[model samples]
Target: MSVHAIFLSMLCILLGLAKPSSSATDTFVFGGCSQIKYAPGSPYEYNVNSILSSLVNSASSTSYNNFKISLPGSTKADIVYGLYQCRGDLSNSDCRDCVAHAVSRLGVVCPGSSGGALQFDGCFIKYDNMTFFGVQDKGVVMKKCGPSIGFDSDGMTSRDSLLGYLTAGGQYFRVGGSGNVQGVAQCVQDLSMSQCQDCLAEATLQLKNQCGSAAWGDMFLGKCYARYSSRGDHSRDHDSHDDNDNDDEMQKTLAILIGLIAGVALVIVFLSCLAKLCDRKGFFHISSKEDPHSLKAEIQEDRYIEARERK
Candidate 1:
């Protein structure tokens, strides 16, 4: 093949390999749609689409953004308010991808709803006809507690300390570890600092009061969430064993994927080096005979020397 053809082929292969992995960040946590539905071709639907597009576009530049959409002739009731917030640590590209995915998912999960909300592990998106911006909503949306292993005073103390540290932070997102316990807390950026603190405080309090003695716990309120996990706690249940097995399988899958990607990258590099060598030697035309001075013959000789040197 020509050098240009080979380069194009490699480019295609690299592009295929460039597809991002399905991270835990994109995992669906919870979502809900309003009971009210909009007309099929109404102004409300148009505004919803516009606001969702704004969210997807803005996510590429910022981790948190809110948009309000109202057409020139649209009424107050037709206005759409929407917002998306990615996890603080995610890169802009990841944030953009996550928001796009969430937008697509919201359509499928809550089609034509006047208002809807979706929360993934990495981000949150919400839109509505009525205003919810800068609102303080402490209502519990979701709560999960891992299987209890009875009461361990030390473990509970560590969890409490870690949670306290998370609540004390003034940032929109906070993470900390204490002993064997690790915890994270975050609030939507629309809230004031004090409101964010109050929301996290409420979430952590729920985790403590409701998830007592559990190895892990999650409490998600309307505008904030808190979660914690303690190491070295194993549940004595068949389900927990199954969960552990699933985790192990996931790890194995990730390892195999990484290995394959590395192998492909090495192949691309080798091919690129070979292309450069061929260009330098003006060996565009393939030679059928095993001429000693040919590119193929030289490559083989170099490999032979390398193998011998490795011994």
Candidate 2:
């Protein structure tokens, strides 16, 4: 194998998607005909069912829809059928825009192809000559941006630390990860946990191949994103909701004591870590802790693995 291939394979091991068993196909794709257009004849040229058209453009930041084409006079399919899905986390508006771009661009790039899917950072859309719901497909195209920087020689250990943290569902974590390499993983919604892990694993490997040794990098796909950055964030503010809820609040500090304690390092460290996590990708906040109705993206599969196992 080439260097890129070797690096990619190694990365896959790190992310936990190296080799997964393919299970028998047991997937279902539902609803797709409302927003589409079609013909009115007995022999359809794959007309979009009214049901499908209505549903295709209906993803409310967390769903998928179907699209189709038909002959001018036929009622039966003579041409094509397909489905689309935006990332489960995107707002409906974002999903709609992404689909419009993806579909229009797909025509320019691969005209007449009956089946394919396009994924943007926030959405994914797939169509095929044959039905494609619930079928496991690694054939979707994926891309990654180069890492922004490099790792310390100590970087490899941190990388492994993150990998272990994710794969073992945080079992191998050391809580005092005060300053460690930053890493994140995500997978499509429909996948089983194992399948999601497998997808993450593949994406991790792809990153290694594409951005070897770079400091900041990401594996981007139609369905998910896995990324890492080298900037050690040790001082982040955490008490956003209640300014008085500081961990240091218990310390009896006369105004003078507070002034005297201004240079303390622990306060800085706690603040930094807290600030970095709340707003970043890969991290998930519990619903009750944060506003449940707030419009945040869906937490990825890997993030849920630990919570799921704990239950």
Candidate 3:
């Protein structure tokens, strides 16, 4: 397959988790375009779409981007409900986008009158035809730690080595926030405090399972993180590095790669390009006035004007 096709296929199949319909009361309805399925004995099989449509519409009406609705159907029980929270630092746009994506996945991952969850890095959405919204269910949580975090480095100090994950209450956090790393927690704002806590705890377990002994990964689906070390926080580290020296490093590496791909000398090409750019106007004017016969002079006054315009 072409690289593009392989990339797309991998993305489509990535969410491998499946909670098969083992429950006598459960029905799994995986979503596909315009496809519909019904629980074996559901008295209101036809109205399932109506129930989902109304709930989604209502959610859109409110600012509840991460909202979900369930229908118990009159013969069964009250529809279960759930919504999740993206990382709190995410803006309104991100929250809305994440929720919408999660909702779409829900139809595919969990269809029909059964219970299921659609998990993502930003959030998780779930529902059953049962009342799960207000209740805190610990049974749903999953956890895994870096069971194989062991590694050895020649120059790195013991303190800088990759370490296994630890819980929030452990000695890992005993230092009480001495670093740039900040602990983050998020939940559907509608969740009760206890419910939020339960959700976060559950998410921690799931992260442990997925990441194994890796030094870092998502703490859980859209809930919270309770490990240690901000230095290993790639998100923050990457963002800060973009400001200056790191940007140059990236540009240099990119220039080299492009040169190789295009069968040209990358460094020489970049330097030549830069030199031409500088020689544009007052590119290398040196003041012979201040220093006797200095090779460099003040930049041509017009070049400053051009630089300002570029900015």
Candidate 4:
């Protein structure tokens, strides 16, 4: 076979074998511990763990994907309040998975802080010794900005449009945009509609102040999240909540399919060339009795006469 044929066959085989298996990915976005620390193995630590366990259990088993629970201790000081909220775009299973990861990460990152907030791309988790449910925490736990891009009106305008849609009858959670500016904003479920809007607005203002020229930015506050990207789909407009997720998944599936098809096509071409080579080498010689008048028979007769004359 030609060098090209052999190389193509090997490449195809490698591609076929290299298909990636579907697996869970970590969704950790950010996390923080309160300045207050609890003694290791103290009753307070035990209480926190107990509260985390309940939150995790409820998150895993619930269909709503938003839940808050409080565990009262023997003394009021041991009481722990916790809650988890999944991004509206996530499916039930995805929400659960994100919450589970967030909860586990909180233990490692915050340890015994009386109050800790764990945020993921798909969910948010927080716990405190003091009650925080229904109360908006104006504290800014995390703020991030994408690298600076040339600033223009589209960036701010698109972000504001997206936020407006979210606050005004966008179910308090929304994803939308146009051109190169797309964004989403969401609030914890315990908050009222107005409270959700206020929290998102506050977060958006913070992002504007900190990352006005950024290609993308996000602000994770006590009870809400607001973000926009000037360069990515987060900035691009979408028809629905899951549109972005579905688009990503579809793109991935298409890439794998294209790879598989290209690999298979290369393999078929290589095999065809190999078969032609084998035929020329007489590995599949025609039977004389089956086709006595065939081209191979005439060539063999000429070869026999030439050999006799040489003898």
TM-score list, all predictions: 0.71, 0.45, 0.42, 0.62
| Whole-model Cα lDDT of every candidate shown, in order | 0.86, 0.48, 0.44, 0.71
Tell how far residue 235 is off in model 4, in angstroms: 10
lDDT of 4 by residue, 96-152 (tens): 777777777887898668889887777778887787778977678788887786767
Tens-digit lDDT string for candidate 1 (1-311) = 75456655755665565554576567788999999999998888999999999999999999999989998778888999999999888899989999999999999999989999999988999999988889999999999888897989988898999888899898999878888888778899999999999999999999989999988988999999988887532111223567568767766765676567667767878898998899789986564575757776878999999999999
Q: Number of the top candidate by lDDT?
A: 1
User: Which regions in candidate 1 have their CA more than 4 angstroms from the true location?
Assistant: 1-21, 232-311
User: Where does model 2 exceed 4 Å of error?
Assistant: 1-56, 65-81, 143-151, 163-184, 220-225, 231-311
Give residue 167's error in model 3 in angstroms: 10
* C-alpha lDDT of candidate 1 relative to the true structure: 0.86
Per TM-score, what order, best first?
1, 4, 2, 3
Worst 10 residues of 1 by lDDT: 231-240
User: Candidate 2, overall lDDT?
Assistant: 0.48
For TM-score, the strongest prediction is: 1
lDDT of 2 by residue, 1-311 (tens): 54345445544553353233321110111112223323343243234333234434565444565545555664444545666655444567766666666656555554444344555544555664455444444432544343344555577666556644544342211111213566655555545566656656666667666766665555655444555655542111111224345323433333334343443444665676786787475564354567544534344555688789999
Clashing pairs in 1: none
